[model samples]
Target: MTPTVIPIDTPGLGDRTYLAHDGAVALVVDPQRDFDRVLAAADEAGVRITHVFETHIHNDYVTGGLALAEAVGAQYLVNADDPVAFERTPVRDGDVVPVGDHMRVRVVHTPGHTHTHLSFALSADGEPVAVFTGGSLLFGSTGRPDLLGPDHTDALVHAQWHSAQRLAQELPDTTEVFPTHGFGSFCSATQSEASASTIGDEKRSNPALTQDEEAYVAELLAGLEEFPAYYAQMGPANSAGPGAPDLSDPELADPAELRRRIDAGEWVVDLRTRSAFAAGHLAGSVNFGIDGQFITYLGWILPYDATVTLLGETPEQVAQAQRDMVRIGMDPAAMATGKPEEWADGAPLGSFPVTDFAGLAQELRENPDAERVVLDVRRPAEFDSGHIAGAVNVPVHAVLAHLESIPHQQLWVHCAGGYRASVVASILAARGHDVVAIDDSYDESAGAAGLELV
Candidate 1:
């Protein structure tokens, strides 16, 4: 059987890596820091990974291609234009790498997501099958052009329109499309959960394909949102050659050491549920709520490069949380597992004020002109769809930058759900603002809580 392309998802990053083989040989594309799944899958199929290819110098996670290729003795490949410390089999557009007796990999120079982006054409039995279009093209939306920094955004977006047009016009309608970023990833220009699409499907449905180039660029540029603060560090790590994947248990900290770190103002991240954390946590610790969309805010809400301590409910949980943090290039100094009451001993545990949707409604009704600022931390597009009549639309990542403009009076915070509200509440509270977190459902609160949606 011709080995079909298998998409391996990294849930924390909301990205997918692919594996394709022709029974005897395989190719790995855009792997994350963890390569266990890729390696194991190749082994199970009894195929050696002949080539490991990167779609770009990724700005989302530290890729594991170099190490994975070394382990399997496979040729690692990257675009010729991508500057990196280590050596790789540099490839350019139209270059084809033979995989087996019947399969060949064609390189397409698709530059949009980055200056040196390339998409792989996977062929079997001398027939075109699929393209691994990484960040260049996604399910519904294309990759955001601003990932390289503000300077490259304008030029990249213009290039993105051309790159997208190339794919639509050149590739056959039946060719399957696989991409690296989508499904809650900040890398995508718009919100979509579509798993995969075909050249025909995209050409007929994608706005970037149907709309004029100028209109596509305008819509694409306007839809970009604030990404994580740690994003700035990703490309550098990938360029310098990241250290070996070490998601192993960080040195376990006893209660005393954990307490000392918290007292020292180190970023002690509580990786429990929001309710568990809000009930009682260490005085100086912050709640990140590992179970819900945790990784997206990990680098944004916490201090970049600060010594971090992970407090999970168990050692296994701590290990998982550590993996999520390191995949995005955030390293923790130490980690521990237990409740704050257990670690705090006699010290007073801290709790934040939690208001339900109804409680916020009552507060607004009573205050009349109190003008309680409902700070919506969701993306601008999400806010534009429907939000509280007077809720301010500053996203979570831009909250710190917009602090000077917000009032010092009573501030109410809510996201699409309660997860982000908890994060924003902690951040605002840390900055000496009177913040109340609405911990209830956003959709439920729309009209039930006397909220007038605009």
Candidate 2:
């Protein structure tokens, strides 16, 4: 019988958790941040996950391999060449990892996306079946060569070329290829809408494999998009285990006790949705919505030096928030207890006033020449679709470091919805900027307010 393969999607972020099962034992691959959902899926499956493998040092989000390993008592594995500071069993090329009586995985070192990228070949009952390509090769395109150093682009191109050829020549043509990242991920230069591909199909259809090494290098080097400025900082955080919290936890603390903890230097993170957060939030708490790429934003705004206590509505939300923090190397001493309203003595972080189209129109009209800077904190694609006329694009993930460039005048920010805008508003407020967060409806009111986009 064929072994079962189960894929679990992490909510908000697009990372995946895979389980390759052979009756009693299972292997999990690339369990990055946003792990609560992944954990639940594994529990439901009732398979004993014995090994956790990381494809590479992740840049876009935190890795959940450590936490998952700890939770399930599994051995964590990464490429032998990786410089991860955490303890992990080093896997190298051709080493077989047994999953059960009839299933095994062979690690193949395929470095190009990073200095330490790995792919795994699966064999069931002594027959080769699939390869977990990780970031080395995707459905439509190869992993970006620019992730390493620009100086090593040529070498990386050659490595990747040889790597693809090796897999194509060595692994059976029938082998299914599963990659860690897909479309919308920053890791790959090009990705298909479809998630998985077969080795035979990739050999015939992948553009990167058809080009000569030099040509491939040239194509990859030309005009790669600027990565989020926050990406550079994330690698190091992942390297060092989450450091000591800059603040104390208040999860068990009552309203007064929570305030005392904050007074003693703990920072509160409001993880509610933007609409819920905007309607009412703790006055000084930064509003990073719990949904949709929350960990990436958390890494961007939450200072490594601060202790972070979460303000979440549900238990699952709270666990997710905690796991996200841990994945990115932010170990909070403790979380705050009770609801936002309960923390009476804690000072308000800042007001994230949720505005409808009309409210934004009135605000824009009232502040005609007051140096009001309208910041559109959406992705490049979203910004292209009709934004507030004159709004400068500074994606929320890249906002904190570039704050010096933002004029110190009054700032108005909006995202597709109120969520990201609130996160940006809180970030600016923390930096002492006067900011007003507008909901997605800002664009609808822009025409009525007579605001024009350039």
Candidate 3:
């Protein structure tokens, strides 16, 4: 009588949504805004989705519980404490929600990530089998308690301590743990490579479990880096019960309109390889390349409501790009495919000049008098641990708002490799700055780049 669990990963957000079924009926937990995947899972399992659960008002990404439940004619269950604008089944602590004839989930009030969060413990044929921990207790780490802002951070941290310990004390050690965050995702206080775990494994391996309440809270708070600014929009959107937008292929733009968007100062986002974009692109077009963390950077900088013109190499690439955008609640205005030269139409093409580590060293030696800034776009932790001498540290996520860090002269940018460096180079180039992107391996040429490792 074991329930089937279909774990779906959203690689961009480092999150997972699950469809748990008892063969005849199914339930979804913390689904992303896009419903097609979850719907497909239900269809493949040959079960009707009868219930959708939201652990809390999600701050990282919009949960599709409301809209998805509506789409499939299922009941959307939310915490009674959350004053969502729409109608939903109000769930309270210790409530046993029956999924089908053989399986039921007992709601546990595990409020740490948010004040109203609830984790569900699944029971199959009256035996505890697994638990949907949501943001409560992740596999190797716990959810960051600071999403509620400064005033509530300490309180949430304290709550997080008790809630985590409570989960361990209440649930059996053998119960499987399925969490919604911390899969190379920024939502966790720290990162873990684990995809799934059992309660017994978590008790021994999770860092928070080893420390006292005060020590755990302090450690968790100190490890948090800047989260995406677009997070502010997610909670409101999810609470309003977002409707499923048409993720169909956008209208293809002719060269005439592509030129106009460039003239009008709208973002013409180019989705290609970093190497490809570095070679050549339409002047005024910026590259947040499709092959790397495209969606994360899209949310990091682009105005949430802005309609961007998309440029990709092929129709298939553009279509794949659209799904990446729609999953994060972004919709592009138009899409086009072709060479930069074709779209440029007699206008000057823009390109980022890539310098290998050795060549970059030679340039600095030759022109020590030249005014230039070596900008490192890695995280603060990476920069603090070790970095090249005189390279200004500005994480790619925070670069858009912190343009004043630009040194007012020539700019040379490098990340650990070249993917993030390409993103920064594109942003600076769009603003009419002279930017050089380093395309070589940072690890191999630490000596060449004159890195200062501690």
Total backbone collisions for each predicted model? 0, 18, 0
Clashes of 1: 0
- Model 3 per-residue lDDT tens digits across residues 28-64: 9999888789999999999999999988888877777
Cα error, candidate 2, residue 447 (Å): 8.5
Model 3 steric clash pairs: none
| Tens-digit per-residue lDDT, 1-454, candidate 1 | 4557888988777899999987888899998888888988888888888899999998888899898888888999999888899989999999999887778889998888998999998888777888899998788778889998899999999888888889878788888999999867788888675777898888887877888989999988877767877888889999987766877668878778877886687877888888887788776777888898777787876667789888888988788777887788777789877778886777888777888888888887888788568899897878888998888888887876887897887789898779998987776675567778888888877578887788
State the lDDT of candidate 2 residue by residue for 1-454, as single tens digits.
Answer: 5777778765444456677887677888887654555667666777787898887887766676777787778998877777777888988988998876888899998877776779988899889998888778788777776765679767776787778878888887799988876555666776478767788888887766677777876776663565544566666756654332222233454566556655665677777777676566666566777776687667665566667777777666777677666655566555554566665555553455656656766776786666778788887757876777778999877786687898887878888766778888877775678877777554556566566654
Task: Assess candidate 3 and give its TM-score to the true structure.
Answer: 0.96
Candidate 3: minimum summed lDDT over ten consecutive residues — where? 445-454
lDDT, residue 45, candidate 2: 73
Question: What is the TM-score ranking, best to worst?
Answer: 3, 1, 2
Better of 2 and 3 by lDDT: 3
Could you give me the TM-score of model 2 versus the true structure?
0.78
- The superposed Cα distance between candidate 1 and the true structure at residue 288, in angstroms, equals 0.5
Winning model by lDDT? 3
What is the lDDT, from 0 to 100, of the residue 37 in candidate 3?
93
Better of 1 and 3 by TM-score: 3
Error of 3 at 49 (Å): 0.9
